[model samples]
Target chain A: MTQQNPQYKKVVEYIMSEIENGSLKEGSRLPSEKELCEMFSLSRQTIRHATGELEKNRVITRVKGSGTYVGDQSRPRRKPRYRSVAVMLTYVNSYIFPPVLQGISNTLNNKGYSVSVSFTNNDIEREKRTLEQILSSDKVDALIAEPSKSALPNPNMNYYRMLEKRGIPVLFINSSYPKLDMPCIRLDDEGIGYEAVKYLISQGHRDIAAVFHCEDLQGIRRYAGFDRALRENGIVLDPEKVIWLDTAGVSDLDPLMDYITKRISTATAVFAYNDEVACQLIRGFNRKGIRVPDDISVIGVDDAEAARTAEPPLTTFPHPKAELGIMAAQKIIEQIENPLMKRDHLFLPEIIVRDSVKNLNKEEK
Target chain B: MTQQNPQYKKVVEYIMSEIENGSLKEGSRLPSEKELCEMFSLSRQTIRHATGELEKNRVITRVKGSGTYVGDQSRPRRKPRYRSVAVMLTYVNSYIFPPVLQGISNTLNNKGYSVSVSFTNNDIEREKRTLEQILSSDKVDALIAEPSKSALPNPNMNYYRMLEKRGIPVLFINSSYPKLDMPCIRLDDEGIGYEAVKYLISQGHRDIAAVFHCEDLQGIRRYAGFDRALRENGIVLDPEKVIWLDTAGVSDLDPLMDYITKRISTATAVFAYNDEVACQLIRGFNRKGIRVPDDISVIGVDDAEAARTAEPPLTTFPHPKAELGIMAAQKIIEQIENPLMKRDHLFLPEIIVRDSVKNLNKEEK
Candidate 1:
């Protein structure tokens, strides 16, 4: 029995040798189980056992109607030597994510690593589940997450801490848990806010409303920046001019629009947190027969493609989005390649001036 | 030596068995390797060997600062079983791909299989490389592809035949190769074209200009549909009205816009092949001070999200997007679970009305 088991191992090794030597090209049918039985002079069960091992290793594909063929076998045979990296985000369907993914994919692919993407749909439970899955799978080498607004006080934070304790690197983008030691790739929310307001102020607008979706850290920083910019320019912050829209637990835009309409009369120029809000507001204004720039000047953050193409064209803060992607990928790669490296990396945002904002004085001239 | 190996295996096996049996939960740290070696009365090398196997299988994660802990073992212990489904497309970052991916993700997630994504980037060499990768990897049990617009003399068609001969299931989505016997998720391009024109005509349109981007199967179908709709309504198809914008070897919208402008007159209504083209037209029209619907009503196909958010909002055909994802996923899952299943599936498209098109009577009133 001892000799028999070793003999089966030898047979399996022989087949692998043939495959490795290029004698068995992909899609080339393998010898039948009966033929293998005859050639190896072994019991059918033993040959089956040997073939089963080959199948488990993904060295061959077994089709019932057809015969087994040599598998691609091109995927690196060397097991991943580094810790796994996990990227958690809300959605993968927009322009924002593809470039991020492209940057990550290109970097990771070059480093001979594989990346797995998981979507949270902004659900706390799903986010928790996804993190748990990543930690448990041990498949992820590192983590690049855009956390749900409810991350703090959420149990998932504990789990994230656990990963940290285990020496797994976790990075946040467009979101942050500042208390956590993990590094983040965040937009200059404060800068964007300041820039939008400064531009409006420079255009000789005394009354400006900054509209923002509030829920997380980014929102807080942006609101702070807006306040700072207004104060720096000696414009007293009007509580009414600061409109905070509740995006928490709200996914639709109708109620938000209603709120904006009630507040629109007081401000001559409006600044929005992101392009989506800017576009929505523009649509709402158009519905009211209020022409953009001519009736009310507007500016928005995030130089998303929508901003540039919206009716009057949106004037937006040109965020270095691709750079953000590159930075995150680079950070993760650096951490992976040099586990001892420790430094917090921050990237700057660029302002892209488009047509959405109405320069009231310029238009009059 | 055999006894020592088995003894070391037993120690590691005991810990793993606790994990598998739920006695040890994920994130729970384990005993030191030295402790384990001592407990098994085996050398450190044997203990290391066994623990290494456990780690490779993703059953545990070892951290530098922290000790080893139980890893996510929720994924099936076996390597993912091979399936017949493959997705071949140009650039994974395009606007149309996400909804399709969401559909595929939801459908396939419901089933027990994983889908492999491959990108061709519109290059024939990359497309061929992707195919070679897919075929050799033995990862895809079947295929769903939107072949490159320029992949002619049908090199891909023959590859599909090769997969078919090997009894692998194949399906096509968004685009089709009619000569191939594969299931396809296709839009009723003819109906969409006819409907777009018919809607414009119903709004009291007379002089109409149609713009097409390319001469691929999709472009051909849309053009034919436009012509058929015009002919059915007893409007003479003016060769001049059908302007084929040279999109070949071009990726930008500026040249196309210039071409349209030079040929444009007082055409009351304009129909475009897709929302992207419609958006470019809106921008071009804005530059020329030509009012939409007030001067020329515009209709587009593929009611992507951007369509609804475009300046005036675009009226378009809702491609069978979600269904395409579901069908592709279902087809792949079926092929994976039951390798004997045959291919050939088709879907339908629906119209979504929005604000981009203006009613001439409404304007008159």
Candidate 2:
């Protein structure tokens, strides 16, 4: 009756009540194992056992890698969900994205779900068009997406509402702009950026410059982290040292190149919002006859492929891209099972020290 | 009536006859626009209009982005397919791969097919497990995979057969070995290597060294190109100048370091199998106090992400990553619709001259 109940038993009781009360209706999906793990404060193994028992008792039906679902025999006969989901993304051929998508596909596929992939390329119009096309088909039972132009308000909230109106479960990844009263799973972009700056400051970097994208949620949030870190450290930010980027032109770091050259003597360290920019910054530095960790230190978020192979390797923050995708998939599946649930997830970034940062503290001593 | 019909009308007749005659049958997909394009020798727009009319008449129902299919109006109505596909790769987060996958997803997605992504990590066991898991689900209607251990015979060919047995279409990307009677989309690995060596020769580099991955198909093929080029130029391959790489430890260029340190003085140029190896080779040369194109000219194949950002911005061959992926997706979709097609695609690599390969002829002049 209280918290004294063993978690697994409580789980069984809670699901039963949901079904009996019609909160969890027949022939609908159940919350993902991950969600149940958190809800019951139990490990996945325990949740699995509880779900397994339910399946055996014919109280629920279990699909591998997919979540448990309410059984027709448990209540009244009803049609099972269409084994289909829509996954919308932006910038498919670049860093962080492919892995995230892979995570989504693997998780969905295991559970016998078919995955439809759509790319908006971060264009709002394209996002709207793609969403409309997918939603109108009504083939997909649920949808998972990365909202385009995530830092700005979305113009396609109506399509999202249509998804809701049609009883399709919806979930977001990366940035969930125009919240649409829906749940999202994203990285702690601001936190990672803040930590990166803090780490640089800890290594005795005072005059640090940064390259960031200005148009997206990740860029804006990371810059906010950078700003917050400097403010807390009593270091005033210099507008001259900030390089604002358009996410679409990420490969063209010419602006970053100019900034690195002009500020070579003054800025002791450079921070990039993502690993690709960091690698570019290093290349730009090399072009100007500046050396990484010697003439200046470099730090970047997202310990992506570019960071690993960049010259001197890069000191970076781990973005946990695949995990975010998995979480997003699970959230959408859970929503499909229960339309009333509202939960958001944010994964934190971790630091990985490579050869990019210069230890000014040791030299000062 | 035999063959004088307008191609679009012919296409319509072809499809309906197949359905009515029980050849194409029920529950099977119709050909893609591209396939229909080839078959009818008509433009895509014409084919689109023909399919559009069919969709409107409800003789065939079109799932957006997925192919059109015949429907049985006399029987109880049922929804169309899952519109799902499985895309398996060796890696997801690295150079050239992300873009390739993006192309596949984008192409398939436009046709309304869902994608299930799987990673093999190039381990045969992992490949088998991933394939089995995908096959067991039977959720995917078609599959596009990059064969792992592509230079060696696949142990998981049986799983591919199972996919065919289940009426699911299969296609390969990058390389196809064990010739599972399925088609593949790949790059001309040998041609690129041959061209790289020839370009280096044109620069008057008589003393050349090469780094290769001897295990994979690309590796062996590229090495063959290297050897053929040397022999054609009346230069015998010195074993000391050949640094064979283990594809698994590609990032750890320690073996390459040893090669550069010991061979840099005698070797005037180095050819790397891919851009990753080229970038690493440059770094190794730098560690040995040798500058790229100053002490040794460098050329590489598969001008990947590493080549673009490397210190010298490597002179390499362009491996059409995205096109290959796109081709594989289209091929699989075609297979699903036809089931009698057996066409393999191999894309040619082109030269991209950057700063890494030094022109010794200029110096001589």
Candidate 3:
């Protein structure tokens, strides 16, 4: 490359210089073979070789039935070259994840970086595959990923390390593996859980039933909050009253329906994992002639659209969906540009009170 | 013009041949400068020159802490090159669109292409900006877009043509513009509408009401079905009973509640545009002391998660959300590989009978 082929290199540089100087723009038609031969004072074969080298280098393309034209390879002068980063999440295209994605995309797009998103469906294997694919990808300058089954040890740590080796920074969103000292934008799920149960206890409801998903770090942390609140309140955490759901998605709600119908007298209130479960619990209770608050008070977390719009307006804690996305994107962009800049962000959940939770001191269930 | 420099050209060709012959692979660590110099029996300066030229050509990258390695551009023999495409929707992180996004991602990923997602939020200005960004992007080889404000004439047709001019294929999903003539995978929304009304009529409900959105092609097309069925049943469509909503997101439902309360005596059955609206109508009816099927029968489209979980599960036509996505991806990939290939796909909506719709002939309001 130091001692270049003089003639073809001259032709390539001439066209490239023209492109660089704004005489040739993207999709602009290049000079025909005869015209190039006249301009460079070279044979048609020489022009053909020059254009062939250009095509090989992806500097131009020969469209079928159309003339040769400039390709997008040559950087546009007026536009900042838009670099792209990716975000890999557990449940994309779900009820809860979209707003977060919206925030991330808005932030990244505004900063001139296109965002690529991948969903792992909360499967460890898919997560491993996705991380590997992303690690090997040259187009991605950085990444924001939510580790799958975060409470358990992951097999994909090597991929993350590989990104580190390649000097491509990765920021975690929501949960992260305990061993990986990664930057993350996370919700204080444990604190939210503690607040939820503490609020119920403060309302004079001593017996609380908790429905939690135990597989991920978020669920485990939230349960820890539940345990802490119950301990501080001088109440025994009932093993029989706890419902553990599968981590991937909605588990069989039949177990919960049965518990709601048969074991209602055991607990005066219920703390659901999120608004979706709370809504389902309400529907289940209504089937057995048990009304919310009037029969069993219920509260949940993640004040999603369903929480606000659902009948009785579920009382829960709001996760910073958009804020999380924005934070994660900003961190990744900051890291991509500076490479040395790194930061961790945490968003604490705020209690959203609605009609679901009843004041036990004022009324009897 | 056709002549090549003997020394650097030989080294470049040697390494390329080694790569092509499976001696070097992607992400494989190349020999160090000292070893390469000794192996080639060349001076350190010559080896440095060759390696620098390789780095300039992106044949290899030199990590600071780590040794030099072959980059993705040199081509791995075992792995196929991963291509990237984009999916642009109005609201990507919404209820209805997530499943479609999922479908697109799953389909494209399976075919070895990475997917980048963008949202325009149904704003024309954002759509124009996003399209311009995508058009100028070299990474996105194809696009699947749901045009914003599709009912009105678009100002972004020239942008779509720009994608065409750059040889990027486009496939529309769910709804499309009338004049675009681009390949699209659409739902038979009008057919679903006709079926919903016909089913209600078959159940001896003639006083049927319809609520639709007028902003996009789907809304208008579905309304056509509603009109056709009402006319076929010999019932005049009531202008007052027909409710139209904005397409961007959920509009305020206060007007709809007013219509439901005031016009309850006029119509016994109402068909909604989708499950979200249908769920809201059911809630409205409940607030007014009206019961499902017993007082009013409601039908909707898109049997989303809300439809299944609503107090009385909503009866509606199922939107082929994932299918449309997969079809669009497949079509885009097909056209990308073979630009001349052009075809349209239509997914017919099927009725999913749930508890929301009542048989009016057997039961009286």
Specify the highest-TM-score model's number.
2
List CA RMSD, all candidates. Answer: 26.5, 23.0, 24.7
TM-score of candidate 2 chain B vs. the reference: 0.76
- Model 3, B164-259: lDDT tens digits are 787788888878877565777888887888898999998888888866654566776787788778777767666446555444223435433753
Weakest ten-residue segment in model 1 chain B by summed lDDT: B243-252
Cα-based lDDT for every prediction: 0.67, 0.74, 0.74
- Residue pairs in steric clash, candidate 3? none
Pick the DockQ winner.
3
Task: Estimate, for each residue in B138-196, the C-alpha lDDT of model 1 and write its tens digit.
Answer: 66667777766421223456776777776566767766665564556667766778778
lDDT of 1 by residue, A1-365 (tens): 01122556656767776765689887788899899989989998888888787776566768879878787344433233553567787662255777777777677777777778888765455787898887787867688888764312233578888886776778787777654656677777777788778888878787888665543556656766786787778776554455544342123344345445655577888887677778778888888787787778888776778787888898887656667777788777665543333345554565666666666677567
Q: Which ten residues in a row have the lowest lDDT in candidate 1 chain A?
A: A246-255
- Per prediction, fnat is 0.00, 0.00, 0.05
Considering DockQ, which of the candidate structures 2 and 3 is the better prediction for this target? Answer: 3
